[model samples]
Target: MISTEYVVSEQPFTVRRTVKWGQCDPAGVVYTVVFAEYVISTAELFYGCLFGQGPQQAKDKYQFGTPTRGLTFDFRKSLRPDQQFDTEVRVGRIGTSTYQLLMHARDMEGDTVFTACLTPICIVRGQRESIPIPEYFKEKLKAHQTSDAP
Candidate 1:
């Protein structure tokens, strides 16, 4: 008999994305604002990968929330419709209640398309109050932290 299973990859989390026509403007270039959505979506997937389940549910079960503290992007190559890229996610600075997710998007030719840093603070879920990073969550992030991460 054959079985199937899913495991969290030891390497950094990565997602492949293709630019669809709908994601472009009349000029056929990806809209500037849409890149934020791509970064956020990738972060959610990274969290889900760590927990072995959906990210929101895992956050809810832990009674904590990760709300964005800051988001910054550095655009390199402009991406047009039909262009494919890959985003690699890495854990960055982790503080008492805040952590950073650094994402790098690269084109098929190995050129950087964009880079983003998403900083989210841990809070008591639904309470609007900051909280320390949960032990298990911290452990998972540490496992995938970047070499320069603190």
Candidate 2:
């Protein structure tokens, strides 16, 4: 119920979303847990941008998988119901078996709401063992990589 309609952009890899009633708590502020959902959903859509298809579909077609290795976030502002914000996605560090997806959420006034980093480790399908990141995936991420991040 956390996900509402979101707009995705490939040029700079951004997702725009509007907070909904379902996403907020009784106190009229977004639930703390919802931030995690926002991050994961944005990452899924980012995969869609990279693969030119749905994220799960791409994973199935490629016969590979990315499992979350780590996730961290820093909240700068509170989001209330009916608020709209932009979650800009930037490709961060690329490692042998893991990569970082940096997501920065900014409010309508251009103020930062939150910043997150999602590190997903690559692995062979159906296996827990790790593998080197595929070249295709690396190249795609590099095309969108950015150096400016705080």
Candidate 3:
């Protein structure tokens, strides 16, 4: 299992989720696709905390949206229905128009069950063209950067 103590120690933005029956495969482990959805949802919550606004609000107010450029995850342990875990999201890297978000989900015992790296690009809402990250948003993301992510 991946050690997540350092990541959690900093108290990064987190979201707790319980694996639901519908999210599991016949073998009772969480379906792989569900993990991606969890990451996306957690990222939304992370952005909400960082910007004081959710995804929709950011688009409406700033005319910019963060769309996933790429995503990758490693499943360290299986999650069964009813299992509760907390996903912690931290800034990994901030680029001109893209930022890398790292996330790890730990079980009640604090063992990492899954880890993900997601690249999201800031884009002009209507044109969907990449743009430099807003200065204020960049500052907030930098504040959450951690060097201990796995």
Name the top lDDT candidate: 2
Stretches of candidate 3 above 4 Å error?
Answer: 1-10, 148-150
Per-residue lDDT over 1-150 for candidate 1, one digit per residue giving the tens place of the 0 to 100 score: 321112234376888787878888999999999899888888888988899999999999999999998999999999898788888889998899998999888898999999999999999999899999999999999888898864
| Poorest stretch of ten by lDDT in candidate 3 | 1-10
Whole-model lDDT values for every prediction: 0.86, 0.89, 0.82
User: Model 2 scores what on Cα lDDT?
Assistant: 0.89
lDDT of 2 by residue, 1-150 (tens): 665647657778889999988989999999999999999989898898889889888888887899899999999999999899999999889899998999999999999999999999999989998999989989998898888633
Better of 1 and 3 by TM-score: 1
> For candidate 2, which ten residues in a row score worst on lDDT?
1-10
The order by descending lDDT is 2, 1, 3
lDDT of 3 at 145: 87
Measured on C-alpha atoms, candidate 3 has an lDDT of: 0.82
- Give all TM-scores, in the order shown: 0.91, 0.93, 0.88
